[model samples]
Target: MTERATTSQPTPFATRQLHPAGSADVPWWRDAVIYQIYPRSWADADGDGIGDLPGITSRLEHLRDLGVDAVWLSPFYRSPQRDAGYDVSDHRDVDPLFGTLADADALIARAHELALRIIVDIVPNHSSSDHPWFQEALAAAPGSPERDRYMFRDGLGEDGSLPPTDWLANFGGGAWTRVTEPDGTPGQWYLHLFDPSQPDFNWDNSEVRADFETTLRFWLDRGVDGFRVDVAHGLVKDPTFPNFGKHPGGLMEVTHEAPYWDQDGVHEIYRSWRTLLDSYGVPERIMCAEAWVAPADRLARYVREDEYHQAFNFDFLETPWQAQPLRAVIERSLASNDSVGAPATWVLSNHDVLRHASRFGLPVGAPRPNGIGADDPQPDAELGLRRARAATTLMLALPGGAYVYQGEELGLPEHTSLPAEARQDPTFARTGGLELGRDGCRVPIPWTKGGASLGFNDTGAAWLPQPTSYADLAVDEQTGVEGSTLELYRALLTIRRERRLGLAALAEVEGLGDDVLGYLATGPDGRQTLVVANLSSTPIALPEGAQVLVASGELVDGQVPADTCVWAQVD
Candidate 1:
């Protein structure tokens, strides 16, 4: 078996099949834990109420303690802030609000010093409407070469008055937007799946493809390890743009289906990208996709050996906290990715969704109808911390790459409210207020409990309000506490890195009870770890012949008493 050097000293033996002695070492991404940091909300320095590169640099020690192998920062490019930096107005330069290019360089250097690789978000499928390229297309004459950069078609009706297609925008509006010609003549329309402010680039156009390649090269040259591509599956759409016929249920399909959604040509595009990435001398650099589609099998295509390294496995996010349903989703995800020789990435919450505490039927502050109310009895802080540890143990023991959303280590709960005026997400406004706003999960990080604004900043106000209860959960407050959730994460991460337990192969996963979930991970070295989680309030008996290593709740006779989980080394 082969061995790779790690910064930490080795301790316990964990089963891992070291690659063949002379074979090329597997990429660092495999079995690595990546922490996602949303730049705007992580930490605010300079009293700007916005997190910047400097702020992130100041917090490297916190991330280092978390034991993550890498950090993935959300976009920090020049933008109009239409989509919170997702709409890139300039790909080469860092947004002044976030910091300068020099600041980014400092961030990279600092992160590496902490033994953490840095990956940035890249949006190749579209650009902000305010981007120069879009402006150029607007200025160029209709049917001109520049106009072809995006899909531009004339009206399709008999009277030349109707839209070219009935495609609905993913953000709930007409996908096509009309633009008038310079001479006041009826001009062409364009396609935008997200917002009208974000126009989709036509991959059919060679010029558009070349421009994106240049963008990729720019970042690779800048020393960014890799990218998390946004809306990757939406890059290539059906060329025919066929309208779906009426459904048997007599309802018009509001959303586009995946079969026609992720066009076959996308494979060629990703293959080309893989070639470019290889040419950069950074072949193992990570490339993950944010793909939302049904039937996990179809989504596996995005990560075929020559395509992306990994794509978001959202089955866990959509599953209820119940053990049976969660088990089914996890098994399906494992089976689906195994077929394609691709690794899966698991995440339960992100900047785009409600926090797990609320999603899992736990009381937020009080009791309401959704299993736990704001006023309903609150679970003890210790109980919450135990559950958080149990969840992490289960996630880390799973046979795949794990993604931890920012601030989850503290067991942070979702914010209850954000004034209507503070809501910046277009989805909330576009849906006519029907959707629960994502602003709740996007609250600012709590830096310290003793300071104003939870030490996130000394400024007037954070972009979003800090959660009221975060003071007790701040990093400073939990770092020294033995059983704190933050410390538990550090321990898990240390084990993953030192013993390399993350590289273990899944031996068996059974005992999926109504409220209990269990699995075993074993390496070729005869080391094994058993992970059992009590997902519900009721306690469950632990399996026999297990040496308890780490646990949540009380332990009795080598088993977790109840309402807790135990991570043990099987004898």
Candidate 2:
């Protein structure tokens, strides 16, 4: 993809008008550090070997003490669990696996009491194949309104033999799936960008749009602070259903001209949602787009003034562990988001990819496979943890918001040796085990050191088995341990909030080599904090007279060690 030409003149930080901490005038999402909770793997309150809302409610104190401003929960809606709740059968109610609607209500109320905001995931690009609407579409005739709500079209060849287009599914194989008619005849094909169990919605249909609005209101009335819109960029597709000539990667990759993603029509949908959110008025409900678009400028469109309030910086997440590329992504991200008057959201890892800790431990240019197996070359645990801490320290020092995926604070590594039969991700099945899929990263996290399932559930069972190494990294093991990863995270977060770093504006530091990343974050009060990351093989001297605040690793005679990051106060 081509990079957008950036103007040399930087916008004045003062003109950005970032809201002060605790100010009710602006929305809380801006500059907030949000934590992502993969609910099904977070905790199990009912002893059913799966996490539920009550389990999440019991864990709120952990997040509150961790210093995050908000928590973004992945989908726990009524679903068939075909794509881990992404295939939603009912948007209005919680699935029994995750507790009842009353459980959801109590969770929201409890979070509010702790001064924590809640942002639920909303999968609007598609619905579960078993949804009532999709069921109706299946039962209805080809030309019926029920079928119009989804992307249903006649097949290409005679007797409906071929799919209409060659667009590939994000998971694998063809994106189109043929159906059997009520009369037992071969029928038209339906589009599903991911799994066959998920049918893509026809966003052009008025009924679909109206229905999503009602779902939005239903949650807003239930006291949710906002939503994290999944597949935000893929909602509105090119009407022609043009073929994507070459499949780039297994994941939905960065393609500037892909007909199915980053369509301009998506802005209109988000703009409407923005209006709905603003209408609430009191706590300022907001939406963050989980768009994987590219070129920085195009990605910024999702967060334009009248559109989404924030968008994930996947470009940053994918950047290799090199200072030069990391700085480039940071600068471009800040520039693009600044152009649109939005804060750049930084994230290292999530439920989808290999954990950053493991990724950083691999060779500098090694590929980041979705899953790691016993046969795969393992990551260097010591090296990975060191770099992970440094990367997070550098990320937290940057301007704007940040996101921490579940178990990241404990420095959890991916469960590389999960048996094949235990894998549940659709990608693994679709790819015929060639790709191990994301199940490795989504394993249940450890809460206590000794348990049958690492304290994930009361029954000593877990939906996904935990790695034995997790016992050492459990919350109970690291809670009050000095120099532990968990304590390091707490300290970093405390410093980040006290310094108001998230509300500051950053400027690149001159004279830093290609092996080092150096920037100064200047707060509204003119207090400057210097953040420097040494990705080089050797030690780097700290700037003269900079008061050291925190370092990812111990300083070696007043110098930042290799694979280390330091945050300091400077005049």
Q: Global lDDT of each model? A: 0.72, 0.87
- Reference-based TM-score, model 2: 0.95
Predicted structure with the largest lDDT when compared to the true one: 2
Query: Could you give candidate 2's per-residue lDDT for residues 309-418 as a string of tens digits?
Result: 88999989988898888978987888788887888899999999999999999898766787888898999989999999999999998878899999999999988899
Task: Give the lDDT of residue 306 in candidate 1.
Answer: 88
The alpha-carbon lDDT assigned to residue 462 of candidate 2 equals 85
TM-scores for candidates 1 onward, in order = 0.87, 0.95
How much is the lDDT of residue 353 in candidate 2?
A: 94
For TM-score, the strongest prediction is: 2
Q: Any idea how many clashes model 1 has?
A: 14
> Any residue pairs clashing in model 2, and if so which?
none
lDDT of 1 by residue, 138-194 (tens): 999878888788777777877556777777766666777888777876778888877
